[model samples]
Target: MLGAMSSIKVQCVIKEKNEIGESPVWEEKDSSLVYVDITGQKVSRWSSLTGQLDSIATENLVGSVVPRKGGGYVIAEGTRFSFVDWVKRSFSTVAHLDKEKPNTRFNDGKVDPAGRFFAGTMGLELRPAVVERKQGSLYSLHPDHSVVHHFDQVDISNGLDWSLDHRVFYYIDSLAYKVEAFDYNIQTGGLSNRRVVYKVEEDDGIPDGMCIDAEGKLWVACYNGGRVLRIDPQTGTQLQKVKLPVQKTTSCCFGGKDYSDLYVTSAYKGMDENALPKEPEAGCIFKVTGLGVKGIPPYSYTG
Candidate 1:
């Protein structure tokens, strides 16, 4: 659908194993690569300076993690949200997302330009549910322990990123194969002017986690497609792509010194042991080069 299966020049920066590894965010200041093992409920950290990795222990069914206001991190576990001081080993539950519908769990999420956390939920039915059109929604977590549901009934809430200017918000609905956009109100935490910025054709792949570069372009991971696609946000045009040897790419983020080293993670969760040989590379961390755009620095929680 998009192109013939191809390979890009990149290596396994980190070889440690993982399950459903996703949500990678490059911490520019620390020169550390941060990501989450969704199913593991653990947050991982890899230092490029030392090439070592350490994990924070947690049991929140974590979907995403970001640097917190003063120190530590804000984690989204299932539908429960909490703040953790990994350094001190203390954690506090900030809010419960699905008090009414306990079956829903938080998926991909990230911090907005204002340092507020935004996360989304998927339909309870593995299949698209009634919430798909309106109920399954994206939420905003502010510094005050407040919450806001921005959109609803999403089939698969996979990835999200913001434009360099903080004026545009981009998000992916995995099952829909669409990366949608909205005019963002940074101060108000409001999203308007909904638009279809990019739609993946069947051949490309299912959209997973995403990151925005300094140029406002979107780098989207193609889950089953085993690759990533670079798209121009303004025109909804596909400009370039990087193919992975694996079959399921979960997420990606720009890391390394200059933000040129793109780190990616894959998943082997759904595959049966019989199908394991078909995707031996499935759950390994990967890297790529010459990925032109530099990603925006992750926002630190101030609230």
Candidate 2:
């Protein structure tokens, strides 16, 4: 049995709601948190210091957002990667992938320690009554605006992070219910020697988004599980688990001035009418405090 860890205090920080909230990224430059509402087609920014909230409408389903070193955002919207001037609310295309596969769209993504942007796609099934086929892939956007296809046959690709040493890369394919590790080349953004570092049983819920802390531990969000887990990647042991008030927990990242706060985003996308009442805060952004841990600042996309 998975042991129950101590409970931590969690609260709904943003009550505006999102259909499929994901990809929470902490911006050290503004001391704010930026995230995406995939189903709603918007990117939101929340200030921790002033409680100010802002959002930008996008043309398509936005999967993720990463800070640019040149003062903008690199976003994966639909099948295309683009640069967004948050100040001007303008977007310019960087690259488009899988144009033929309109059924596939980009999902979770993050920037590597070396400043390359990596994102993965998944089969998009709009009809809740029908099941989507697994026909997705992972790609890396280079500094020169080139893209490299890394892996194919991915299903609901989500959650990515690198180790503190920059030698190990971690990823999640939600349908597989496992976290995979790779031998990483920090200089070239290459991955190899894939292995499973952690696995989630059916009862534990599927892993969604994830972030690594300064101490080299992983904090993973549990979609449909109403919780976030802190795991020791080396031992594949559950170090801690935080229970939330709602299911459909999508993604999480360490934010706040000291990077001690764990900000989580949840979804209301697939919930039925019966499930909606029970989870009133389903689509809200949650904050988990008192973890006493710190995280490294997310690297910006230098390109």
Candidate 3:
């Protein structure tokens, strides 16, 4: 079935800008949203019920943050896998990877259905659109505290999601401008049979963060494209497009009580003083509603 094409509304819910706001997850437990700011070095949470926002300062670039079933958050901070105690506002490192490569850091990540934390790394961003290519890899953190290296030679590991039946894994290497799928093993948390599921056009911008909705369609945030695309994974066709006011729409995830609201994150990292004026809402968090679709609940890390 095709996705909705109804007119949607975009509202800026969070006005305080994040240098690079990414990795947004709906924390259903507390009725809040959790996300990270890479260059800003912070993990933040915005309460939907109370209208309060809280942030914890990190020592290095914090890539992603996901709720842990063990009663805290599992985060990829720099190259370390750490546990975050949000209430006390602290985190402790559990493991570290990528020691051989000094410039790489974790980028975007998510939890698989079987509860493994999957995150990938990227080379240092020397400047806008310029990064050390092929210096990164994707890793899986099992519930047992063991890390498995999935693949290497990645320029920018950006987005991730899974199929409805839990048999397919979808991912994005931002620099590749495409989305790939792999045969997923729910029992073993292994992936194989990698192939392209969606090829993004150059005019649509680089595919960043993504999530799957209830209808099995993929919603992809287009960095530098200023839009979110709803795609039919089976046919590799664009079904719907939701435009945003900001040019650097970094990532998006469905939230709200019924998961009908699409929350989008944007970035102003590359915008200079002259360019920033044109896009006044460059770094704000926006909520897109009235799409007439709902998203499934995101999985929390079992580890």
Candidate 4:
């Protein structure tokens, strides 16, 4: 059973030119916040220490990233997979997005507890931004650089997340109203028994990114919904809603030692600027304290 939403208050902590700050992560070592701008092709590392903002090229339209156990990060580019060493400022191509022909780009993804990185792809077209539906696939990247597609024909494969127990997997198909769940097998990196956990209100928004709390409750950012929803995976129950001052909330992650701080990202580029103040915090980062559940430690890539 999941817990109910508390009437606790949360606030936006940082503001930057996100355009589309897709994935916000907490670097456990330095206690800084690192996130990526998909359109900007910028990877930003924010330090609370000196109140300084550092950024570097992700080399391409980077969708999501995670700190590598060895060093630097594993980045998903425009159909290309690579590694980025922040210290040396170098990029390594581990895999190509299209050894055949570029058709998709990486989106939201994360490291599962069992030490494997899971990510999904989205159909991408530059200039005027033509996004196609069902032109995507879900993949698992092993430490050895071996890639496997668990499924294909994904409609805007947006967010890939796992349960704290590493037994359940939740994913979002942006533009599709449904947020789906699957029986996750950590040992084999396999998913089975897929089901729709929540069919979001189309009028409200499309499901973008998601996170699971310590108690197994699911939290999802409704990209165009103006709020984040708390859900129960087993019963498909809506437990609560955390309202945001933005319409294009991209994603959220739990950081801080206690896992009590919720960091969220938003998008300002997609919406009509004429309606900016309608969401005063459109491109800002938000924080929800005293309301988060601990997440599993990011998988370290030892291979």
Candidate 5:
């Protein structure tokens, strides 16, 4: 079944059923989509035009995957930031964190406008929805291969994107149920003047991965709400919404020839045995079209 948006068409593009699918990145070079399967411990690249999907398995939980400016890709897995060699299908650690907390692991992340990779971690997940502590922190990996700790005590560092002017950084710590913006200094990679842009009501579900459109509006994925909301950051008003057949809409990115297509990721990790039967497309990747909007290209990690 398609979503409630009558004018918008939502189709399942990938039916691989990732355990915990997150982080969808559009690779314009090859017209492919790159994403991660956290609990599945792998990064996958799928060609929407050809329907060819290739995956590289990692040794630990892989949270996010983004293209590197030099080559291959950068991944946030376990407690470290690693480089994924596309040709060799291997990983090389570049930076590590949370040495003392064995339960914490890297989560959602993305590259900034300046090519710095910003990724964060989450506390121990006792189960699908039960996260234990707030020991996770947000960090940035510079092009020079240096890691900078931005802040601490983040429960689930998820969505991240910078404003068009590169002066504001938008982020989401899922458990907070709100979107926060920081005054960003592009040159120094510094953040200040943090403020709330909008709040995600409990009924709407936890806000997960996010992206910004050319119009400066935000597109946020509602984890258990089965919807993607287009919100105006300044007024906290919902401009539009695209519903999905599945509930766990993890993350979203703009792709396609003109960057007008919205690609969304989902998960089936915590669904009960009985509940899983009803949502057959829970772990699939969806492509939403007819939205009549274009998105900005994502930045790659220069390092």
Candidate 6:
């Protein structure tokens, strides 16, 4: 258990609600924030400079969105990894993962510092009266079009990031309620020596998406907890907490000119009618400023 820090104020930047908002990424090149709405089946861009919001509809449930080195975006749709030319609304499949299990869908993902795209899947039974299974797995897609299985039996593979030095890798399995660390090899894309680095108590909410700050602190979104927490990975202690007006805080990332604005995404996918009125702002994108800290720019996929 970790002590709570003072609450910080957050403001809604985008009011266009999403069914399940996740994967908030800052496109430094265009000074915009890009994210996906899984259930809504859309990828959105919110420009900070012009206050413009644009969206491209997808035929499948889009999991994550990250910038490509040259242009376009690498996205995880269902079990397929694909590249999307947002400007033209065109997409091409890169690879199909876990094709045998149609019940699984790609979830949270990001590119490593070495420019490899890593995404994971979770058992998502969409049919009524179907029970979900723990058949999720994490994988890394190299620039050369190679896929490597990193972990298996993940119930809900979510947040992922590496330390500033790139020697330590941190991951979150929402169902496990713990942040796990691994010894990372930047050159080979190898993760070993896995161990629990931080645990979220049941009351604090389940951990989902995460981002590392310039100071090396891990900021995690607490799903159904209505807050984003900052923790010291080295000591596994909670350093601070930023309360949000909504309950389902899905993911977060740092953006803005100096990378000082923390952009957060939320969800209203599972909220009941009674819960909706209490959290009217549920599904809106949020931003927290004045943290007096910065985050490292996310690496774009070279492939």
Highest lDDT: which candidate? Answer: 5
Q: CA shift at 213, candidate 1, in angstroms?
A: 1.1
Root-mean-square deviation of candidate 5: 2.3
Candidate 5 structure quality by residue, lDDT tens digits, 137-212: 8989899988899998888889999989999999999999999999999998999998999999888889999999
Residue pairs with backbone overlap in model 1: 69-301, 131-153, 132-153, 134-152, 135-153, 136-152, 136-153, 137-151, 143-303
The true-versus-predicted C-alpha distance at residue 73 of model 3, in Å, is: 0.7
Compare candidates 4 and 5 on lDDT and give the better one: 5
Clash count list over all predictions: 9, 0, 0, 2, 0, 0
Cα lDDT tens digits, model 2, 81-154, are: 99999989899999888442778888899999889999999888555212365677889999899898998888
Deviation from native of the Cα of residue 236 in model 5, angstroms: 1.4
User: What is candidate 5's local distance difference test score?
Assistant: 0.91
Cα misplacement distance, residue 116 of candidate 1 (Å): 0.7
Error of 4 at 257 (Å): 3.6
Give the least accurate 10-residue stretch of model 6, judged by summed lDDT.
Answer: 1-10
Candidate 1, residue 23: lDDT: 78
lDDT tens digits, residues 53-150, model 1? 98986775677888886877888877877888777776788988754256667778898878889988775544321234433578889888899888
- Model 3 residue 297 CA deviation in Å: 0.7
Give lDDT: candidate 1, residue 47: 85
lDDT of 3 at 248: 91
Off by over 4 Å in 6: 1-7, 98-100, 125-131
The lowest-lDDT stretch of 10 consecutive residues in candidate 5 is 1-10
Residue 225's lDDT within candidate 5 is 91
